[model samples]
Target: MDEENQQAGPSAAAAGPAGRPAKSELVDNQNFEGQFKFGRLVVILSALAFTLFVSFLDQTSVSTALPAIATDLNAFETISWIGTSFLIANTSFQLINGRLSDIFGRRTCLIICMVLLAVGDLMCGFAKFVVPVTVLAGIAVFLVIPQSPTSQGRMRDKVKMIDYPGMFLSLAGVIFLLIPISGGGTTYDWSSPLVISFLVIGAILIIAFIVVQARFARHPTMPFRLFERNSAKILFAHNFISGVVYYTDLYYLPLYYQVILDKSPLTSGVLILPLILGFSLASAAGGFAIARLGRCLPVIRTGYVLWTAGAGGRIAFGPGTSIATIAGCLVVEGVGLGLSMQPVMIALLSNTRKEDRAVVTGLRNFLRTVGGAVGLGIAAAIINNVLLQHLPAGLPRAAASQLSVLLDTLPVEQRGEVVAVYMRGLHCVFDGRAAGDGA
Candidate 1:
């Protein structure tokens, strides 16, 4: 129907004797290094793994420090912005980053992303004011620059270039939608004039961005056409299904610890280790297992099933639940996440050429990350609504608001009781489960 649409097919050149990359994807079916240079491969993988660790650590570490940041900046309303800003920056440009890598080269983009991420982290660490936070966040978003690589039988290729226009439109679209949603209740009233105006503005921005991409943006970041890649489709499937729970973990786990268990910010950070550590170890393992097994279908299915189970456990950990019980659930869920997460990625990569990998992988990761954020937001709202309905009259009125909000308003003494309410509320939120079930 459109010119971009007509040109949207996978690279016709993918059918190398050694590999079958989709159209426009230049996977030369040739392994220049021959027979896996174990030493060099290990070094390369280690760098990638280190990057993953730093990226993930930055992502999670902030949760632990949020309270301090909030207190220091007096940014009670902008609390959500801290996280939302980064997500918007990181996810919005993911497709663009990918296209850029495919067109220019992955190395340059990745290095740039890493440096930008480092700068962002440094800025976040030192951020004293809201403007600094926003500015730094905008700059730090350069971290998610890797493109998704397509896997092939017996070989793989990475993206050689990057797409700028596609990425900009997509980034704009994500930011436009999230600006209002992220700040809805806290910064502005959901139904208020300004919030509603922002909502309208975001919609228009996204609509405009999409129209431009579909018509213009050659070498688009998302290449809406590239969804034709089977791996791309499956990658999304993995994120969507896994995302429901992956997001829930990041969304509710912290609140559960701080709000229910009444743990200090530092302590809350320690508590999430089982989940984060478990996932980190398992993801690496999953990659190895997938590489050995050379197929992803089984791993994907298994991970999905386990993830659902983990979600069940998380949904069940309520106010009265045993600390040990919650911890146990985290370990189990972490293992499941680890086992499934990397394997699916490997499986997806297994089917793609190296050139497309960065963008595709970035897109997949972007969706999953956003999914987690959205899930967290929904869980927060649900928990808040439930708490409001169930909070005993004796509790402070301010204590009855959303967890993040309430934490900011009340002093430490009153927070314990509020935390108990959150735990119990989450219990009920989890499909009518009681927090006292563990007792």
Candidate 2:
């Protein structure tokens, strides 16, 4: 009887490893560790790192080269459009990529994106004309990015439902808003026909997109379910706000260095290294820390304080701030950015099931990018308005326009007086001062 009962007990507890007991395996996370798991983590990190590296290099390296390129190409006015065009195209594509990533896989889409990036780089390196290079670069971006969600594996179940509607809304909203702002200060008159057209089109599309997402799609991309939680909304806002702060810092610091500190263009560009490098490093660190600590809120709060202080602090202190102060600010901001960014990414993932990760990521990225675009325009507007205000009262229109023309002609020193005037005007405009009628 005992022997028979012992054999019967074998099936009593729910199955575990070999039917020992189910609870043991459930309690221990040990089985989850292995080469395969670690390898997947590595691959994800590698992909993300590559994405950041390529994008950063492209943005930063160009500033150093823009002057030289413009001088040789005689496209001073055209140069502004280069950045504007890139932003528009990049934003537009980011929206679509999120949807495509869901249909294809993230890993596959990313590889294609890298290929596009490689081609863009090749064209930029070789092309004499900006048009071909810029257009190709845009196409490359379109091919490379897929707007799918990132998974810390939270919203896994909702994956299949994420696709088009929300993306179109975001794309339209960004395009319309960005066109005017990007052009308002530079490429076209603030009120130019081109700018107006973009604004109008963008607005109409965004409104239509929202309607489509709400009324049409079976599984609309924007996960309204997540927003019902306060934390997710906070996280989204943090990403958006942080981006704005970052863009402002990135745009202005170089101007301050070149204009106020009297550094060369190369020097100005180099001076910004600490901030960008700090951001990249901090992001990696933050991601690691989140995995280890498993405490999301504190890390994010700390990050917020540091980034805000670093960015907004300068607004209060002014140009006389010390180098050490600036460096400290950069490091702190980087830390904050790392802390907030990764955790938010994690939060969105944690909040949802595994499937919805791509959708969440796409939505988050779109908002953050939009915030960045807005920040760029705000910074530009500040500089432009300042220049307009500071313009000396009776400067003859002819001389002023000549000065503007010269400034637009070529790079410093390599460019004749015309280039010099343009550089001076750039400084004057950024510094929030107008050219003296005397000069």
Candidate whose TM-score is highest: 1
Per-model C-alpha lDDT, please? 0.61, 0.59
Candidate 1 displacement at residue 144 in angstroms: 5.1
* Residue lDDT tens for model 2, 193-238: 8888888887888777778766776556554665777877877886
Estimate candidate 1's alpha-carbon lDDT, on a 0 to 1 scale. Answer: 0.61
The weakest ten consecutive residues by lDDT in model 1 span 430-439
Q: Cα deviation of 311 in candidate 1 (Å)?
A: 2.2
lDDT of 1 at 225: 55
